[model samples]
Structures are given as structure tokens and as C-alpha cells.
Target: MNNLLIGYARCSTDKQDLQIQRETLTSLGVAADRIYCDHGLTGTKRDRPGLTQALAAVRGGDTLVVAKLDRLARSVPDARWIAEQLTERGVRLQIGASVYDPTDPMGKMFFNILATFAEFEADLIRLRTREGMKRAKAQGKLRGKQPKLSSMQYKELRRMYDSGDYAISDLAEMFRVSRATIYRSLERTPVSR
Candidate 1:
């Protein structure tokens, strides 16, 4: 049976471009049709549909290709798990231009090290983001989403509603806000019994 190259690529955010990885895989001799991709999916996730398809496409004597180790799996345990599965299925893993030999002791160590680094990098990013948000908040720069209307605006909106001179739709149009916003604003004031 002829061996085939099944390529997989992923990006955690839709904003991230998978074009480079696709180009890299194509350059590595994988046919465009043979490539599967996951957009807005993180490496920390194991249930990626693209990864599943890629793995399923590879049979004995077939190779699974990824642009990088982190693109395949982020955690050490997940990496080892995938490696073991491939080894048992007699499938080879190609990371970029390098073929990872899971049977070799040194190869296993290297793979584990790479996975550890990927996990560490993800953790550091989370830590840095939290720290930055905390600092921003302390400086009063991170007050999330300012209210659409001021307290005075709410009072005026409520007064107009109580006057009964304007319809709800008219009030919304006059205030340049939605009917729901008008309702919410009016609700904020207690009704007089």
C-alpha cells in the first residue's frame, strides 16, 4: 500500500491566519485536499475535528503531518497519548520537516520536552493577561463597557414615559436607543402607587 501524508493545521482565534501553515504543509509535499484545518480551536483542546479527521485519514504506513508540535498537542500527556496511538497504529508523525520517532528513547524525550514548553507558553500567556488586566483595573482603565446612558438620561427617559405624551417607539426614536433600552431605563425608576 502506498503511504500518504495527511496534514492538520489549527488556530486558536479566527483572527489568526492559517494560510502560512497551509502553505508550509503544501510545501512539505502534502496535497491541499489531504489537509484538514481547525480555525478558532486551541491546542489545549483534544477534541478538534480537524485533528480527528487527520488522525483517521492516516493508516498503517501513512504519515500525519503538522506544521509544529504545538499545533498537534500542547500538553505533555496529550502529546504522549497521540504519539502512543500513532505508534500502535504504525503511523508516523512528521512535525514540519522532521519525522518524530516515537520508538526511539531520545525522540520520546524530545517530544515530551516540546510539549512541556508549549504548555508552559500557554500558561505564561494566561498569567500575563491576568496581570495586565489587574494592573489596568487598578489604574481605573479597565472599567468594562461604559453604560450606554447616563443617570440623568435615564431620569429624562423615565419622565417622558410617565408623561404619556410620547409612545414607547417615539421615546426610543427620540432617545436614539432601542425599545428594550427604553423599557430598561423606565424600569429603573419605581412606579408610584
Candidate 2:
């Protein structure tokens, strides 16, 4: 199985092309049939069918190849998990021109450092998003989508519901809103606006 090389490629969506990764794998001498791809699927998701198939097809001594580290996984833990699985199965992991050798201390150190950077990058993005949301709220532009019913309309609906003359279904129908919406309206405190 040492001669057997399996390649995997992924794109975030159907609109994205796998051609570049495919060409890279081909140039690396992996047969077209041996290459697997997940289209319109995010790298962050572990449930990719194409990746599952490629892993299943791997045999002892076979090499799993990808064009880049991110193409294989989006996070550090995920990349490490895949690498561990390959090591357990006696399969080699290759990224672009370099083959990862976990047994080599330098290689292990390099991969760990790279994975840490990827995780740090993701964390930074999340922090920036939180800051942006805070800024929006400060500007009074952070209100979510407007309610289906205006404040006055909701007050009227509440009054009708409290009277107990109308069934919830009937009120929902009259208001042209879902029963859940009516229940939510009943639960809410009076809105000034």
C-alpha cells in the first residue's frame, strides 16, 4: 500500500471549483479515480461524505494527501484528530509538497505551531465579530428584525386574548399569525412603542 496515494479536496460551496486542488493532486501523481472531493461543503464540518469515503479507502501504508492544511481541516483540533487517525492506521499524511512525519520531533513541532496559529486566527475573527456587534448596539442600529405586529396591534391582541372569549386558534386565525406568535404576545410585557 506504500505506492497507493489517496487525495482529498474540498470547496465551501457548489459555486466554488475544486479544479486547482484536483490539478495539484494529479500533478503529485495521484490517479483521478483515487481523488475524492466534497463540493458545497465547509471545511469546518467533519461530516463530509467525500472525506469519509477517502479515509475509508485508505489502507495501511497508504498516504492521504491534501493541497493545503486548511483544505484538510479548518481548526487545530480537527487537523490533529485526522493526523492521529492516520498515524494509528499506519497511513502517512501529506500536505502540498511536504509529508508530515509525526515520529520526527521537528515535524511534530512544526505542525503543532501551525495548528495553533490557525486556532488563534479563528479566535481573532470571533473577537472582531463581538466587537462589531457591540459597536452596532452603541450606535442604536443593533435592533434585530422588527416584530410582525406593531405595539398597538399587539396590545389589542393581548386584550382580546385576556377576555377568554376567543380561542387561541381563533385569535391566531383572526390576526393571521401563528398560534405560537399569539402565545408569545401574551407572555410579553407591554411595549411602549
For 99-132, candidate 2 gives per-residue lDDT tens digits of: 8665467867777777777677767877999999
lDDT of each: 0.86, 0.84
User: Best candidate, TM-score-wise?
Assistant: 2
Per-residue lDDT, model 2, residue 47, is 96
Give candidate 1 regions above 4 Å deviation.
Answer: 144-193
Specify the poorest-scoring 10-residue window by lDDT in model 1. Answer: 184-193
- Poorly placed runs, candidate 2 (over 4 Å): 123-146, 167-170, 187-193
lDDT of 1 by residue, 86-133 (tens): 887888788999986667788778778888898898789899999999
For candidate 2, which ten residues in a row score worst on lDDT?
184-193
TM-score of each candidate structure, all chains considered together: 0.71, 0.76
For model 2 the local lDDT of residue 164 reads 73
